[model samples]
Target: MATVNPPRGMRDFLPAEKARRERVLAVIRARYRAHGFDEIETPVMEEYSRLHAGIGGDNEKLAFNVLARGLDADAIRAAADDPAALTDLGLRYDLTVPLARFYASHRGELPGVFRAIQIAPVWRAERPQKGRYRQFVQCDIDIIGDATARAESELIAATLDTLDALGLEGGVVRVNDRRVLDWMLSSFGFAEDERPRVLITIDKLDKIGADGVVRELADRGAATEAVEAFGAFLRRPSSADVPFGEQQIRGALPDGVPDEIVAHLTGIGDAVAAARPGESGIPVVFDPFLVRGMGYYTGTIFELAHPSVGYSLGGGGRYDGMIGRFLGQDVPAVGFSIGFERIVDLLEGEADAVDRAIVLVHDRDVTVAELVAVKADLVAGGARVRLEQRPKNLKPLLERAVADGYTGFAFVAAGSAPADIEVKPLA
Candidate 1:
């Protein structure tokens, strides 16, 4: 038999880790529920084109292609000869594509503006490291068909509260409008075709400092003056007293784009502040430098990050036109995705610190009704119950359960009701 271990970059979460994740997920789910969002599930696999079409930049590169499955050993061996014929399906790149498909198919049944919360695993075939993983879970909440800024603002506020609830402290939710990035780039003298490549380079500013970015522009063949100007442009603090004097930003706006694009951004800034005043619980800022790598985002783009982690816990933005690619009708939308795996990594200590636990009874010939009753009673009394597998010995079971993270135990004899259980507190 082959060695039994999860594939590289994936994980086999032990019981303790699973419980901790569940607790974090519960807190997030509670906030989503409070905000009146419904829950929807999307498949783990989707066709390659549908999943990757609107997914821009590095994400498309990282998608894990699941070309064949259950294809017996013979077929698998044949795939080694011809790989191109293998990319029929892929692990979903992200939740947004699946959500877009779902919305397109069920728009009629859903309310005019649909709000949903989705929690699922997403796969990426990246080189795995301490914080970067090939497989991870995304907890996303998105609202579609409604073009209201208030909805977006509230979602940001709710996301902050949810993060706080989960105990991943000190994260800053950086906000910027893609439209604003468009404005800024045009201000810096970039044409429409150059925008994607330029923004891709600019997105690296945080990882690679200003000098590095300037060097990248030079390498890309941007003129020295243009590169220097672009650097100077990105570095200009939003607080700088330089008024919106020149047509730099304004000229970038497409012909007939109302002045309201700039105005709407200003309004969004105010709404963000008003939604959560003071204390910097999760500070939101207008970063001219926040050019998210994805090409699909058409409006506001945001990311949440911690000072130490240096990568996003998760980030998302308004991809107002994504649904139109499939449905053929534009349905404006905004969303945010929480990186559950990153959150778990950043919060591994929290789970270690938690002391609560439960253990199950071990016995053969126990009546199903008795076992069920016992489980129900403990649950009703606010205790978690973990039923022991059959044919397991008490000593090894107790040791395993404790090592696996259980702080309490209850033993019920075979054919007995839960009322007859001898609840023992395990140390």
Candidate 2:
């Protein structure tokens, strides 16, 4: 017998769950649209070559590759030594890579600078757990072809606005720059070739602590001086206290951290502050050690963190080199993604003004025509109407109506007119 459930790491949303998800997505879509981002979509799968093109970082390994069709057993056996030979396509693990491909394909049709909104499902081969899903939606807003800090600033502003619109106030954004990390590494005596591997270890600072990072780097046969220097820096007094400010950004890093990187981080804060103003409650933190796992991040990187969650709500960074891989020329790009599944779980169910919903509970004796007729009248009056057959037990049906976000329910008879039905508050 087939298992009566969705695949692991996937879900089946009931009517109420689907509605709640859609309601939350509506808020996100509208907010992104208001900020001048035009929604776009690409195919869910891309060529396996593109998906594994070294740009997707660790996610490429997690890609669900599709095997080439019509392969004979001989051919399959031939390719068994190299699994990639049997595959031609793979599901995207994130939106940025697809967006890069899309921009390259349609560069001529797009504006000089493109603001895009992509709210779509992405797949990864992850072990499912609470707040993590292999098949989950990602809500992304990106700006491509703009080299200045303006792109990052606009993205941050829009993100904060969308969070506020979703009633998720007090969300914090931790900011960093890839360039700062590179500079800091050089200052600490790490050689050019080893910086990538060194950064990988540095990213573990949170989980392993300073001593663990130093020990791991030393064991990995990293430069003795570089490890000791960085270890000293990490263990030094903690200067990056929050309430993100220009001074705090400076204090977080070593003395030689470049001025341009500092200015870029501060500029984003100033821009967001101007657009959102004093009333906005989100704090932007500057973390020198924020090494986002994505290797393609070129300049700035930021992650959205909330006090209530142990993990990041969402994050992204500048990957200026990404579009160039597809288009054969560099194009500045920055994006911020909202972890849709995580945010949806955190949102408290509330009434959406867009839906003034009601239910028409009709008996078996009532004609479909009559039921629909009453529903039509209510719908025309700007109410979202649903017609349900009245069960012998009315209490359960009425309770479900409330749970499904119907504000009121009315009893309808065989030929009851809209005016004749008395609507009672389901709440």
Q: Give candidates' CA RMSD values in order.
A: 5.3, 1.9
TM-score of each: 0.81, 0.95
lDDT of 2 by residue, 91-157 (tens): 9999999999999999999999999999999999998998778999999999998888899988888
Whose TM-score is greatest here? Answer: 2
Off by over 4 Å in 2: 240-246, 280-282, 348-354
> What overall lDDT goes with each candidate model?
0.75, 0.88
Best by lDDT: 2
Q: lDDT by residue for model 1 over 1-427, one digit each (tens)?
A: 9879888888888877787788778888998888789999988988877766755456877887876656777777777675445567888868888899899989889998889999988888889887777888889999998786766776777787788777765667776778777776676667777777777788788789888898898898765666777777555554433222123234433344346665665555567667667664326655657887777888878888777676788888898888999888888999998888778777777755445456766577777788888888888887767888545447878888777777788766777776677777776
Model 2: lDDT of residue 224: 99
